[model samples]
Target: MKRNLLFSCLIIVCSSVQAIPISLEYQGFYQRLKQVNKGHYSQVELVFSVPNKEKCRIQSGNISTEKESFPLIITKEQRLFLPFDEKLKSDRALINLDIQGETKHCNIAMQVRAKQTKMEYTHGDIVEIQAEMNAMLSEMQGFPMRYFTTDIAGVSFLFEADSDVTVNIDGVVQSVSGKLRLSRAQILTLTNLKLSLKPKVISPWTNGD
Candidate 1:
């Protein structure tokens, strides 16, 4: 996860701060830093503040880049995943947080640890991937089988900015020697499966089943 995971937070100051739940402090936030052959903009959680529910209610939100703006809905928990980009800081992108109320006191946290990614996964990681796919399958009704067979066969994963990336299972260990040096696209697909992508549909003439 050397150049892969980037946790870039831009914080603004207000008044004094309050305490946050100790458990939420260790959560990870990821954004692709270097140029990857294939990738998508990752949505990383940003906590505006641990606000008093009575005081702060986000009515609406959005993010603006040089080209476009996308809706950023804040959850009732006061946390929302922002569309993260390595260039967002330099692009001077704007984030609009519309709050019905405000909290003067909030908590600020800082921590550091070695980053992790999907390629270096264990059995537990596979469970995490399974949960993600299950959520997708539940949301996108009537999806074509071809879309899932690829992952089921361990064949390939789709990338938004580039093409589908395939990995050699045998070579990752003994199957494909030196194949560990996968391109960025392949790496990203293995890691960021939570991305909300437009599901591909089966062709009318093709046997989707």
Candidate 2:
């Protein structure tokens, strides 16, 4: 019978060539440490979810850490930036995704925190005269003056000065100097400072055991 229809068409072409046209999922990854000008910059953010409708194309990725091995540049709106090193001592990382041709692997875990603040001044060049005497004594003592503040990951100043205040280190300046002793209308404040990134675990990439 045509040799059993040519052995059932070679078992349906080897089961559609072992089927696996893309179905990788591990949609999470993050790491960011910033403190520029004084030098310190690190960033890593990768997310994937290609449920496979057929259009697959993301042909490169890698970010193994235990010493170093970062190389993942894919942007044109595809998004996946990972090459801004310096400040990743280790919090666990091992991601590799090369979609389309197949090659997925992940095991990420990071929860680092380093939002610093240190102040001390007696005359570090008078720190802009104690930030203009703490914004004119916080608008004539009406309050709402943390000696200068702004969010979105930048700008914070509270001075009383004794040292370490030269200014213009850029990276959105976050200076806090103190020797504690003001009277040009005294005003100094700091509350709820912040910076964060948490991605406990996102392991999911298996197909070949």
lDDT of each: 0.33, 0.29
Shift of residue 137 alpha carbon in model 2, Å = 48
The C-alpha stretches of model 1 lying farther than 4 A from their native spots are 1-50, 105-209
Best by TM-score: 1
lDDT of 2 by residue, 111-141 (tens): 1112223333233323333343233222322
- What is every candidate's alpha-carbon RMSD to the true fold? 18.1, 22.8
TM-score of each: 0.30, 0.16
Q: For model 1, how does the per-residue alpha-carbon lDDT over 32-83 read when each residue is reduced to its tens digit?
A: 1221112221211112333344544455666666787767666666555554
Q: Which stretches of candidate 2 lie over 4 Å from their true place?
A: 1-56, 59-62, 67-76, 88-95, 102-209
Kindly give the stretch of ten consecutive residues in candidate 2 with the minimal lDDT sum: 3-12
